[model samples]
Target: MGTYKQQSHVVWQCNYHIVLCPKYRFRVLTGLVKDLVEHDIKMLCQWKDCEVEELSVQPDHIHLLVSIPPKVSISELMGLLKGKLAIKLFKSYPQLKQKPYWGNHFWSRGYFVNTIGLNEDMIRRYVLHQEEEDKKEETNGKHFTLFD
Candidate 1:
C-alpha cells in the first residue's frame, strides 16, 4: 500500500476547469479562445512551480491539465490562475468589461479539480475531450447559465 501523505514540493499532476458567463453561449467563437487559453496557460507554466500540459477554452468553460508542486493547495492554485487570467483577459480585450459576459463574473465561481497520478493519461483525455462532448450536445440545446 502506498502512503497518501504528500511529500513537500513533490510535483503532482492536477487539472482545474471552470466556466465563463452564460452569455457566451452563442456569442463566443473558438478561434481566439486558443489564444486566451494559451496566454493563461503560458503564464501559469512560466510561474515558479506550475506546468500546464493541455488546455482548452470552450464557450462556456475552460479545461486545464497541469502539474503543480505539493506546497500549493487546490484553492491557491485556482486563485492564482483565475486572478491572473482575469486581469490579463480584460487587458487583452478591453471590451470584456463593457459587453454581455457570463454575468459580469469574467469567471464562474467554483471549479473542477482532479488529482492525477496513475491514470494521468485517461484523465488528460477526459479533460481535453470536454469541448467535443460539449459541441455534441446540440440535440438538447441545453446550457448551464450559472456556475454550478
Candidate 2:
C-alpha cells in the first residue's frame, strides 16, 4: 500500500501529476526566472499544506508531482498557484510585463492534471477478498438475530 496521510478523521493519499505552460508557450523560463518559479511553487504548495514530490521547470512548460490533502481541491490549488506565481513573477521582474505577456498573465489558461494511485487490479483483488471473508463469517455458526 502507498504511504497515507491522516487528518483528524480521515486518511488519504491523493497525488497528482500536473503540467503547466507559459502564456502563448513562451520559452522565457530560464536562469533567474526558472529559479523564482520553482521557489514560488514550493512556497505555494507548502502554504496549502501540500507536499511537492517532484518539480521540473522547463523553458515553456513545467511538470509538478504533488501530494495534496483531501481538504484541498485540485482546481483551487492550481488557481492559487498560477495566480500567485504570475503576480509574484511580474512584480519581481518587471521586464516580463512587456511583449507577449501584455495581458498581465503568465501561465496559460488551462493546465493538465492526472491522478496517481495503485493499479486497478490490486484494488479489485482486495475488494473481492474482503467480500469472500464476509461470506465466510455469515456462514459460520455464531449468527445472532435481534428477534432472538
Candidate 3:
C-alpha cells in the first residue's frame, strides 16, 4: 500500500540497492571525474525512467538506491549505464584510458545488487491480521465483497 508507479498495464514499486566499483578499484573517481559521473548517472537514470532514491559516489566505488520499472531488467540497466558511462568518460577525458584502464573498460566486471522492500515483520503482521478479519467475516455469515 505504499507509493507505487503505474504504467499502461502495471503498477510496481521495485527498488534496488546497487554497488559498483571502478575497474581495479582505482581512486580515479575524484575532482571533475566525480562530478561528471554523478551528473551522467542522474541523466541516464532519468532516461530509463528510474528514480534515484539515493546515490553516493566515492573515490573507489559508488552506492546507488534506485527504483526501477519492471519493464527494464536490472542487468540491462547496469549494462547500459556502465558501458555508456565509460565511453562518455573516456571521450571526455582521454587520460582515463591510460595505465590500468587501457583495456577500455571503466567499471568492474561485477557489481552487488539487493532488492529493497517493506520490513518483513510488518508484512507478516498484516497477513496475520487479515486472516483474523476473514475469520470474523465467515462467522458473521458474510463473504468478503470487493465493492462493499
Best by lDDT: 2
Q: In candidate 3, what are the lDDT values of residues 1-148, reduced to their tens digit? A: 2588899999899999999999889998999999999998999999999999999999999999999999989999999889999999999999888875656888899999999989989999999899898899889978966776
lDDT of 1 by residue, 1-148 (tens): 1223445655344444433332334445256754776676667756746666667676666667666656667678777777777777667766667745642446666676665555668879989998888877844676665564
What local lDDT does model 2 show for residue 101?
67
Compared with the true structure, model 3 gives a TM-score of 0.86
State model 3's lDDT. 0.91
Alpha-carbon lDDT of model 2: 0.92
Backbone clashes in model 1, listed as residue pairs: 21-102
Q: Which regions of candidate 1 deviate over 4 angstroms?
A: 1-29, 102-104, 119-148
Going through the candidates in the order shown, the clash numbers are 1, 0, 0
Root-mean-square deviation per candidate = 17.7, 2.5, 2.9
